[model samples]
Target: MCRLFALTSKDPVSPMEAIKALDVMKEGHDGSGVGLLLRDLGGPFEEMKDAPILSGIFSEEGIRKLDLFMMDQGFMTKYKMSIKVPKQTLEGTPKRGLYLLRAYEYPDSWNVDTLDEKELATRLMMTRLKIREMGEEKKDMIVFSFWPDTIMLKELGDPMQIARHLGLDRKDLKARTIMAQGRQNTNYAINLYACHPFFIKGYSTMTNGENTAFIPIRDFLSSRDFPGYMGYQSDSEVFAHILHYTMSGLDLGLDAYKHVITPLQDRDIENHPDATFLKHLKKSCRQLIIDGPNCVIGTLPDNTLFMAQDRKKLRPGVVGGRPGMFAFSSEVCGLDAVIPDRDKSKDIQPMHLDTAIVGPDRQEVKICRQTEPLTLPL
Candidate 1:
């Protein structure tokens, strides 16, 4: 398993000192990086990286002779787990702040994307604009958070053919994740959360005959979901359609031509009503949980929830997905946990909220709130 550690200090410290205090030894050979905080006195944070080799400290012992660190994946992960660091080294230097940590598989694998104080502010600017767009809708809007793998399946041509290419038995594979080398490995990696607006367009266009659209909530209101034979091709589209139907109570199709598998129900039923459309939707959503689709992204007003791994249950009040405050996690559960708490805290909340409200009407909005700048730890 790979091990990672993050550190923050009250004062600025040398990159070398930070690593040593962490008790990260030279032999670990894990790639390392140092990040500096950037702000709009100018630009975004820029990343600096170095290849890992044997630590120079180890060269004197003749185990390896190199000033640079080697990015030996195995060696780095195994030993770094137990490395220790002293807290005293964090005393007064310049400005104190938070940082990131990671274990790189290769020196070349190191990647950095930083948000400057101004950049973060700018992001909030864009988010507010989005929220405004959402608010402008005459009808309630729902977005289908498409799972990337499902889109990949549609992209790879017919599902059965993809299964065959992956050497997966029709009986075992669900026509997804092209099984590589006879159902042993997975080749078609799908990053569901990474789904961009372009991908949404691709998936939306796959319907058999009806003109499907990748309508941004800004432009179109979705029609209700219908059965496959009735013309609904994908659940994501259906999800949006149903939400619009629920919010508007206007049928997009005529009764003579339409058939309802699940009848549309009223959203404001005071007492629990059986056999309503809302009830049907709830039942289906619960069933979907048991069906094993990775719940990486969730659709909610003004935000979306994305997890790196499956999340069995969701805590209420957790919301995220502003442009700058992207969710980052090794697994879905990790991100779910991180998002809610981070979003609630004083530090992240203002920025997230500020972004959502600034939509199209405003050209620029200045942020009076300031967060202590952060750096990425080695």
Candidate 2:
């Protein structure tokens, strides 16, 4: 199993904190790869929240093509943070040329005053796909996300070692919310794209169990005709897309997400307050239901962090911390490494019917159980 660690705090913290937490749970995961998704960013990115940031790796020729393409697309480079890769990288780390986090201004042709959020998101996703396709042949570019206040860094090797290789230990690189994974490489080959903490638009998620229902779920999502749902390099990628679809596509609430992905059985649904609605959801979303052993941890567009388990509840995960800060990990030791001062009695270990959520305010965690009333706004 891969080790999943996510933290959301009122103040920005370095990604090294999460990396160190993953190091504590190093025994659970093989040193195959590491993926980090930082959102609600800090440092220089904190001042440029409006600008969409592109995070990925690029070769020498790829950077040239990216610059020209951005120019043609009318996006101006507002700010760029390029990692200075050391001459000698840790063994097993891929030989990457350029690691970049570039924030771009709105296109010259667009009316910034009238542009809506959805339109902006669509344009950014399309541009990212175009760049991805351009580099497919030579493998010059490997773009993870193109969204505001978000930056993703991924590489192959031990999590802590890769962190140093990418200069993630620096003070300037920080975010209020971070989702990280230490991959085990049990199912898929050791490919960078197959790394965890997948992102689409503004939603991001990472999982810690084999997705037995990946193919059908992928097929259902692909049929939706969404460009951002195209990459299925890893089975866990579907978790992020499923989130985008349920909340953004269907206009559903967070509680509805657990219902759609892992709906209650008929016996349980019959006792639900919204049984009629739940029945319809189960029937309509049958293809999306996940059969697992999986534990999913994710962050919404608003920076709300959540963790949910499959029916089997085979994967281990826990959330613990005080108000203004919280950490979710696959093991208690991981949380102890980050926020040891917190009360252990309050730590949450969500079961098959629970979804532990911490809103963007960094307030207390609210556990929403499947048996409870679905009171969240729809």
Candidate 3:
């Protein structure tokens, strides 16, 4: 098991808020690693939302190589900010190099391709793929995310220790939206890439349970011509990819997320008010179905946050907080740590049939459930 915590608010807050919350659930995680994502960025990143931030780590030699590579690829750095830790001691992971967070103006073509955003996103994914693959043998550099309006950090350590290492003290690292995960390694080795709270161009997800449907999901994604779908260090990573595939790849609305991940039974579908469409979804994209004892918390490109539970409802999740802030958690204790005095009546623990959505500004909160069957013309 792992601990997943995310908080989105109208105002900027330090990463410590998430760190402190995760610390409360340390029993569920082994302090193996930490992945931090900040969006609706405040502090230094506040004014630079238009530029794509390229965040990852590098070695001394790797830095030079990275400069050459980006220059060759038509990337020019617009602004840069980074934190480098020396002699890190955290769990069983060994320290190898320096980490950085830098923002760049998108390659001119991509920046101007506003009409074809997915094509641009695919370019970004392919670039990230090159960095991860080519940098492997030399272990020169690793880039995590390259997107406008957000920054990501991942490292092997206790969440608190990693927080300190990040210098979260000043508002420099503040953001209105922050997500964190305390690692509980159940799959691949505790490599940085395998860490929870995975991110793609604009989509991100962190899970607390294993995805039993991994192989089929991987196969479906791999068959796509895109380069981002090949890596599967964590089965839950596919959750984010699947989210990307469902929403961006197919231009489907958010409701399709449920149809693809956890569909209704034949009887349940026949009985559903939206049966016709649901049945069409089941028949057309059956490859996306997820077999789970899994519960997921994630964000889409628009920063619309959501939470979902599998059919078995095996993993625990609770969503509750004050008006300006909504917290998504894997347990009630995590929510209590975020908004301890939250109204008990307003607390939401979505069942298998429900998906909880909180808007970008906390303006509204609603539970999206399966629609009732409707009578329609044949």
Per-model root-mean-square deviation over C-alphas = 22.7, 1.0, 2.7
Q: What is the lDDT of residue 109 in candidate 1?
A: 32
lDDT of 2 by residue, 115-233 (tens): 89788789888989998899899999889889899999999999999887777988889999999999987777778889989988888899999898999999999999888898788
The TM-score leader among the candidates is: 2
Candidate 3 ranges with C-alpha deviation above 4 Å: 109-115, 372-378
* Predicted candidate 3 versus true structure: per-residue lDDT over 1-378, tens digit per residue: 888899988898888888888999998888988898888888878898877787788888888888888888888988888676656555555665777778877766555556477677777778878878878997778778878888888888788887786576666878888889998888777687888788877989888888877888888899987677767888889889888887777777676787779888899888777777888978877777878788888888777888988888988888998889899987788888877887868888998988898878786567888663322321
Better of 1 and 3 by lDDT: 3
**Against the hidden true structure, what lDDT does model 2 obtain?**
0.92
Clashing pairs in 2: none
Q: How many backbone clashes does candidate 3 have?
A: 5
Count of clashes, each model: 20, 0, 5
Ranking by lDDT: 2, 3, 1
